[model samples]
Target: MIVYATHAGGRYLQLKDSLKEQPEGKRGVYVNLTNRCNCSCTFCLRHMKDMAEESSLWLREEPSVELVKDQLESLPWYYVSEIVFCGFGEPTMRLGDLVELLKYVKDIHPEVKTRLNTNGLSDLEYGRNTAVDFAGGILDTVSISLNASNAERYLALTRAKYGLKSYEAMLTFAEECKKYIANVVLTVVEKVENQEEIDRCKKICEARGLRLRVRTYEDK
Candidate 1:
């Protein structure tokens, strides 16, 4: 499915079915853009989750921008607090489409917040500074995966296509994102790293004037 809602147990509900099962109140709606990524992170959910056929995030085919827009247009806007670009793979892999979709969301529902969950390697993938594309208040928040405090540990975890340079590039992207996006955050999964590692990561984020989020590993 192109659009789905995530629940407490890593459960995913298709947009159409979400109306029935979705809890009353605002929740995040995730948009699945593609199943391609530039990194093979050791702790990626794609390697762990056993998704069902119907509710799977693995898209049979990448949906066009128009298709994604239509899907968004059909969503229950009142129930949505945030529209997130995330899925089994990195959302920025389809950077152009993602920006367009973000624009579409702002055009129709300016009150709704929009965010991107990315590995922050878009610059390396596109061979240019991609953070500028997020200007114009189209995106409200950008959550980047800052998996490790150092380059060596980062390369070991992410196995990014950009080699050892990936970690620095990601930090550069985060620094650039601060200029465009209003809320810039870096994240690391819990349990994977010990207290010292987490503390180091916090320091890294603090040094960059960014917030650090410790995401819990969801096994469901």
Candidate 2:
């Protein structure tokens, strides 16, 4: 699906189905731009879930920026609280398109919030400080996967294409985001790591002045 909403059980559903299932409240609308990622995280749902064809976030091909905008335009404004750039893969894999879409959303609906869910390796992917592209308040929140407390453990879990240094680069990207994005969140999945490890992650965030979010196992 190019644009969708999530339901219970971590189910990906069309906006129409989502509304039909639960018709009343505002919810975050997710945009799936591509199915390309820099990391192959062991615990990611992309590897674990078996989704029905119609609702799968795994895109057959990357949607054009105009196509994504068309989907965004079709959304029921009253029911949308936020617009998130997230899919089966890393949104930053299409950085230029991603930024343009962010701007498009704000230009169309300045009041609605916007966010990005990322692996935080855009710097390594682009070999530059890519977070600056979000300047001028086009983006509000950036939730980066903080898979482990240290570089080795992180590499073990994510199998990032950039190798062991991917962890540090991710953290650096998160820190750089603090300058441009309003809310910078570093996340660690609950069941994927032990309490000791989670605590260690919290410390890492604390020392770095970043917020740590312990996501529920089923959270997406």
Candidate 3:
């Protein structure tokens, strides 16, 4: 799906169906830009869940920027509180397209919030500091995955293609985001890491002057 809404129990639904399920109130809408990722996290839902073809986020092929803009243009703006760039894969994998879409959202609905859920490795992916790409008020928040407390543990869990270096790069991206993004958040899955590791992660974020969120296993 190019655009969709997330429901309880980790369900992904079309906007129309989401409205039917919850007829009132605004909700965050998500865009699926691509299914390609740099990491194959051991706990990634794409590897654990089996989704039906009609509702699947696995794109048969990547959509053109114009096509995604069309979908965004037609969204039920009144019911949307936020626009999130997220999918089964890393949104930054399609960094340029993601940025264009973000700007499109801000242009059309400056009141609505915008966020990006990322692994925060675009620095390594693009061989440069990529957080600056979100400058000029295009993005409101960046939620980066802080999978583990240390480089070795992080690489072990994410199995990122960049290996041990991936952890540091992700952190650096998160820190850099603070300059451009209003909210810079780092996240760790609740059960994926124990209390001890999570505490360590908290300290890591604290030391860097970043925020941390412990997401439930089922959170998309």
Candidate 1 per-residue lDDT, tens place, 118-194, comes to 99999999999999999999999999999999999999999998999999999999999999999999999988888
**Candidate 2 — worst ten consecutive residues by lDDT sum?**
46-55
Clash list (residue pairs), candidate 2: none
My TM-score estimates for the predictions, one after another, are 0.95, 0.96, 0.96
Model-by-model lDDT, in order? 0.89, 0.90, 0.91
Residue 122 C-alpha lDDT in model 1: 98
Instruction: For candidate 3, give the lDDT.
Output: 0.91
Candidate 3 structure quality by residue, lDDT tens digits, 1-220: 8899998887889899999999999999999988889999888876666552444788999999999999888888999999999987789999998998999999999999999999999999999999999999999989999989999999989999998999989998998899999999999999899999999999999999999999988634
What ranking of all candidate models by TM-score puts the best one first?
Answer: 3, 2, 1
Give the CA lDDT, 0 to 100, for residue 29 in model 3. Answer: 96
Whose lDDT is greatest here? 3
Residue pairs whose backbone atoms clash in candidate 1: none
Model 1 root-mean-square deviation: 1.5
